[model samples]
Target chain A: MRRLSALALALVACGGGGGPTHVVSGVSPPVSAPPAAAPAPAPAPPPSEDASVEVGLGEARLCVRVGGHVHCRASDAHGERPLLEEPAVEGIDDAVSLSVGARHACAVLRDGGVACFGDNAHGQLGAGVGVASSPRALRVKNLASADRVVAGPLHSCARVGGGAVACWGENGEGQTGSSTHYAEAARELVVPTAVAGVSGAASLALSRSVTCALAGAGPVCWGRDTTQQPIQNTPPAAAPWLAGATALAGGGEAVCQATRDGTVACRGSGALVTSMGPVALPPMTSFGVGASHACGLLADRTVRCWGQNYSGQIGRPRSEIGTNVTVPSAVPGLPKIKALAVGGYGACALSLAGELFCWGSYPGAPREGGHEPSIVAIR
Target chain B: MRPTQIAAAVALALAALLDRGARACSCFGPRPALVSPGPDHPAPVTSRVRALVPIHRAAGATVVLRPPGGAPVAVATASRSMGGVDLVELTPSAPLAPDTRYEIALHSPGQYPSTFVFGTFRTGATRDVKAPRIDAIGVAGAHANPGAMSSMCQSADTVVTLDGISVSDPDRDGAEIALGVWIADAAGRVDTKKLPVYWAVPKNGHVQLGRTSICDPRELPLPNAPAVTLGVAAIDESGNTSPVKLVRVALPPARHP
Candidate 1:
């Protein structure tokens, strides 16, 4: 069985023109003056693309598992930017899976352990609130085994051994499967708490404050949806129209899933951002979601994206960057893909033969780091 | 517990204002008189915050609301950080009963303490459109004698304290006013920036002055200052403000002799 990868983002290939660096948040403006030899190709050798395992994108950074190790590069001055010099994450050796969030990142290890690093202000790092955030990754406590990990802006969750879903971090909207007072300190979860009532989960997706897990009981979701009435700390009703969800991905505005029947279903305020719910697209092998746009990998190895198109993330003409695409439009110029991810403001895909192609904000940010950012540099 | 007049908290506010005395006051009184619960006394109608903020950072204070003889309603409590004085929020498990008297109790520092009663939010509700006015400000510890209403009193060489400035919100008794205060020179110029904005809860319709004096001569080295005066203006949660009242300061008749 092929191990299907998930993380939908905008559609396209690298070098969609240097255009303009449009960062919604985190990526700071070029703080230092351009070095004497700035705006050239990457100073370091390009990543070994053939040996790559998986790729993860987030609010301000990117991560990839290569040669059984995890490496990441981030934007934001106080974020993981310092580690860009040596993108190999400071902790963990045998990382099996990788996931990134707004300002934090985490990976699942071969031994079924989990390590996270980045902002802890909302405890998204699992170090609890007020604990200083460091680039060094730290193991999440109380969990001896985890199958997969998913991280949202202010919180995160992991699939436990028995398929029991556990989550931590901010719970202002009770998004963590637990409730927290509105206070910052009260809302942070230093450790993961098992989300009751969810089991046998095959896929999960987390966004701003909404978390949806596709499990035996169907597609049940919880937390606060900016588009719906908040159902906190309680079992959120399953989306009636979203049964048999085989793959899941979410963005700031919505969550979409690829069902076993080969159709795609999406719901949330993003419907207003673009025409997202119950999209009539062809049978898809998998899909990835970015902040406000999403891309799907068709059985024939083509990519199509729709939704907020600012920065031309949906493969539309650069002139149509700010316009929204209601229809699933094809992302022109791409080879067959094995897996892909969406985050920050763009999308990237790993070709079947192991070549990497990214488009719409390639190598998202701290873009002015002397060397132009392109492929995920797996050292 | 009775609304005992223990002015220590005010002294702390005053001492804190002047970097002066420690808060020597402590009175565990009746539960909060349910006023509109915004971040810290704003408009009273948000469902998100069913809080009693009068506690004002009382250590380990817990607010519980219950129907008389009924089981305590579950509530979520937290200390809301409001720059000046952090306010505690108490979100009851459910909407409070209408026109009904619910008990508001402080579980900590127990004994003879009784829950407070807040029921005016009943009926169709007539909004208090009028901003409460300040009849006057009475000063204590300004020497044993005084002249006319506008006269500045004489004082001793060391400490001068203002118990609490009073306000009249006739629409409701026991009303609390968020007062903006500052020190001015006899010429009536006040450095609003260098002032302490405090709250005063009126009792018996009298100006229960609960703050410290702004006339700490050492702190106010105004060449034109011993004539340093006090400025008090009443502000309602609805962003209403009263005319500024300037009170002349009375320094000790004999200092640095």
Candidate 2:
């Protein structure tokens, strides 16, 4: 307490108080402090229950919901921001499940309703067909039983009370599980469209072009493939490679899943990923996938990552980035984690003790800091 | 497109593109530029500020700006503290020509002297009044000839390609132009709303739209409207539209049944 008091006094003396402190765990912005906004280089957010974080695939921004109130911070070319100081999504309280798309985000509220915010270019927000974007979270029309929600680059899907899922936004690749009927209203579905095929879905793994569901029928995938090949639109097809996966996370053109037998299977081009074999990898519980990389949390709470380290998203030290990028390696210096979210080039891990450690930040100069784990104060 | 439609389209495209560029790689801007987008910065720079090009740890960095089809603009380099980050800011020593696009070549000291294409930015009036111009359009997938729209039919789900579509803008770089493709049935019912603007650039003077099922034109209503048509257009920083090219995709006879 005495040490903290001294530090606070020093910060005040240095003019670090009274400005809107967008304090979170992040390296200072690339060029300079943001225009007039205050950023506090403070410690991590204090530990608390019912806290979770979601990072958009390919990472648009970050949002952390604690005790039902959601705080978000987005990075722009303008430099740093007092993220979380201003709630990106106003009135996003009591969210039960959440998912982050490339430029948008959605959440399943405890009331069984779904709400979304951010870019609505393709109508991912589900407010209306022509609604471009939303500053506040808006409720979806005609959806009231979403079990869980998942977001992709151009669309969002919600798993309802049953094993079915409802989707909205761009169907250019039939990602909305249906084709555009060649009408303006059909191009971007303003209301949620029930995803056809596959029922009893246990979980959903969605990327830019691929949407997969793990269920009793094994792993079924739809939408376009990595090479822009159109897959099934209505009835999702079984991915022969993704059989019996327990958990799934994906990004870029790759999909990686963890099995019940403690085996992690990742199917992607050798250019973007490497297998976790030759030497047996420890069993994993859940994992996160980036553009060309992936990270999995072990039952023991340690994290192991593999694939491209172009921006050190693979979690290796700065010096070791180009080395063994395709090799599945362990990310050092992370505590036992509770949840993990991976964007195209970065990854974040929330610890059981309420600290969030993120790496692979490319804010400026191939070094967004946190090439290793950097504490982000979520409060 | 209507005025309201144009506003909405630009708003949607810019919003999504900005969010994407922000989280993608080394972002270049006038006020607070990000450094070192690695060997290749694929994400387009969206800043309209043309005063400062920032580079981090650029003590020995060399900055070069080459305008489109013109001579290189000379710049003086200096170090300054902005927002607590060490920046090697590159300022044009002389007034840059108005309404021009410049390709940037930056070489941080210690790397090879040869500089790769750093990225690009547009310099002109604070509020852009000009629009982008798309000259040509080409497709590389199954489609009925313009003359045989009724007789020739193609699969609705076949992935289509928009190759050799050229887009250029003097007020903004091609990176700033939002290009999109919309599919409409014979009844003129469109599939994608707002054309779904995405990152498009000129490669070898052609808009690199790549391949997409975005033109997955809906299976027509019936025999009366048995064909789907695709229209491609480009929207500029000011939400101005280019000359649209419409390609018709005729479905097989059996598809109607």
Candidate 2 residue-wise lDDT, B114-220, digit = tens? 23233344454444446667777665344322332211221233234456666676664533454545555556655443432222333454442222111111121
- The fraction of reference A/B contacts recovered in model 1 reads 0.00
Candidate 1 per-residue C-alpha lDDT over B198-232 given as tens digits, one digit per residue, 9 for 90 to 100? 33444453332321232211122222323446676
Question: Which stretches of candidate 2 lie above 4 Å from their native place?
Answer: A1-58, A77-84, A181-188, A225-235, A268-280, A362-368, B1-257
- In candidate 1, residue A119 scores what lDDT? 70
Candidate 1, residues A219-315: lDDT per residue as tens digits? 6777764444552234355655456555666666466666554456665555423554556566554566776677766655677877666655676
Candidate 2 per-residue lDDT, tens place, A146-245, comes to 7567666666777776667777775545556643311122223356777767676665666555566665556677665543244323336677666655
Clashes of each: 16, 17
- Which segments of candidate 1 are over 4 A away from where they belong? A1-52, A76-85, A186-189, A225-237, A271-277, A320-322, A362-379, B1-257
Best by TM-score: 1
